[model samples]
Target: MTRKPPPDTTPDGHHVVIGGRRWRATDPAIPDDVGARLRVHLMAARRAVGVALRAHDPEAERAARDRVQSAKVALGERGTPWWEQSPEERRTRWQDGLAALDAQGAQGAQDA
Candidate 1:
């Protein structure tokens, strides 16, 4: 029978700890400055992705504006550069933003 390992370690024996019910690797701790900078970069990246997705999904222009605004709220208008943001954050924001734009465009076309 498969048994659950202690919360301090993974089933495979990797050292991990539960924080807020999420598993985190105990080794290789992230520095506070690095984490803070990462957050700033993430916010900028989210905005840039929304902009790029707007090109393909013309209908999403409005939502793109909203997303850019949210990211701005988190990172501010002159926060970290979008180029420095992580790729994963950018991709996720893009997928959601592009879909929103596509829907908006389709709805507009239907109305016309």
Candidate 2:
């Protein structure tokens, strides 16, 4: 009897292919510390989206999506691949993103 081959996936966890179809995966270049912080931001943004929806607040919803986008860009999932960037470039990308998030939080606090 013939046996089926196992699915293929990249060692970096950035992609997997099964049945001749490709699928997306999270970027692997994110350091563990940065990854944990990004995860917290992502989850909070996602919850904000849900909360905003319940409250029928369009502005809050948009802000939450922007937060999610920023976090994704920081993780190199939305913009250029993190693996493709030099160490210095990667550092800049993440630092810029984090600064923006912090500014947003500060502005939000001032607004409230």
Candidate 3:
């Protein structure tokens, strides 16, 4: 399968335009390994949201959505715009997010 090209970002590199819609871009400062891990969490959370919806489980949906928000914030796609933060703050944001997501995963495994 052919892979799609990366989205086009604004001249300032703050947001990406996809299908004529603009969205905040992930922080460029994020290390590739860290970013990949965060994306994995984000996708998993998204899938969980879908699963919960299919099961008509409101509580599960809410929890899964919360995870989605956390992953987005950690990726610098939500909450305080990454551009507005200092380098140190940006680093802290992603690191803290990763830690929280990891903890959640651990908790989830125990629950299962």
Q: Write candidate 3's Cα lDDT for 1-112 as tens digits.
A: 9999999999999999999999999999999999999999999999999999999999999999999999999999999999999999999999999999999999999999
Sorted by TM-score, highest first, which candidate order results?
3, 2, 1
Query: Can you give the TM-score per candidate against the true fold?
Result: 0.29, 0.72, 0.98
Q: Taking the tens digit of each residue's C-alpha lDDT, what string does model 2 give over 12-112?
A: 66666877776544456557887787777888889999999999999999989999999888877678876778988888887787778777778878988
**Candidate no. 3 TM-score:** 0.98
lDDT tens digits, residue span 12-111, model 1: 4333566635443311223355335434544544664676575776555555455555433333222433334475654444444345544544664697
Off by over 4 Å in 3: none
State the C-alpha lDDT per candidate.
0.46, 0.79, 0.98
Model 1, backbone clash pairs (residues 3+ apart or across chains), number? 2
Highest lDDT scorer: 3
Q: By lDDT, is 1 or 3 better? A: 3
